[model samples]
Target: MILFLGTKSGKEETKLLAGISCPYCKQTNTLSAITSPTYFHLFWISLFKVSTNHFVECSHCKRAYYKNEFTPEMRQALGID
Candidate 1:
């Protein structure tokens, strides 16, 4: 028998914070908060979360930006201090 264990990474849209103008698409009310999780998996099942990251994505263009890249207003809307 063989055991399979490894790490897996995935992104999830956590919430629809206040919509804002998107820099890439030049659109309004398109940015949202997304959460990315890297985790340890066993037999295709996520066992434990190893780390987490936050991002801002443009719904219109599907562009993603790291938390640090988010503007002050965006971070404030997301309740990130």
Candidate 2:
């Protein structure tokens, strides 16, 4: 008998937080929030979610920032407490 099991990680864009100037690119309306989920898989099929993480990105510069790194305004924009 043989068994196949492993973990898979993926990222998805959750929603558009707001139109704001990016600190890195200094561009407006380019920052957005993304959700990254890590999960367990069996036979290439997703079984259960292991963990999830949130991030902010600048569409202009393609820079990514973790949720905890978000500023007060940014957090509020995303409706995150």
Which model scores highest in TM-score? 2
lDDT of 1 at 11: 62
lDDT of each: 0.82, 0.81
lDDT of 2 by residue, 1-78 (tens): 777999999657577756667777788888888887998998889989998888988878899989778877678887
Q: What clash pairs does model 1 have?
A: none
For each candidate in turn, give its C-alpha RMSD to the true structure in angstroms.
Answer: 2.8, 2.3
User: What TM-score does model 1 achieve against the real structure?
Assistant: 0.66
Give lDDT tens digits, candidate 1, residues 17-51. Answer: 55578777888877878777899999989988998
C-alpha lDDT of candidate 1 relative to the true structure? 0.82
Query: Best by lDDT, which number?
Result: 1
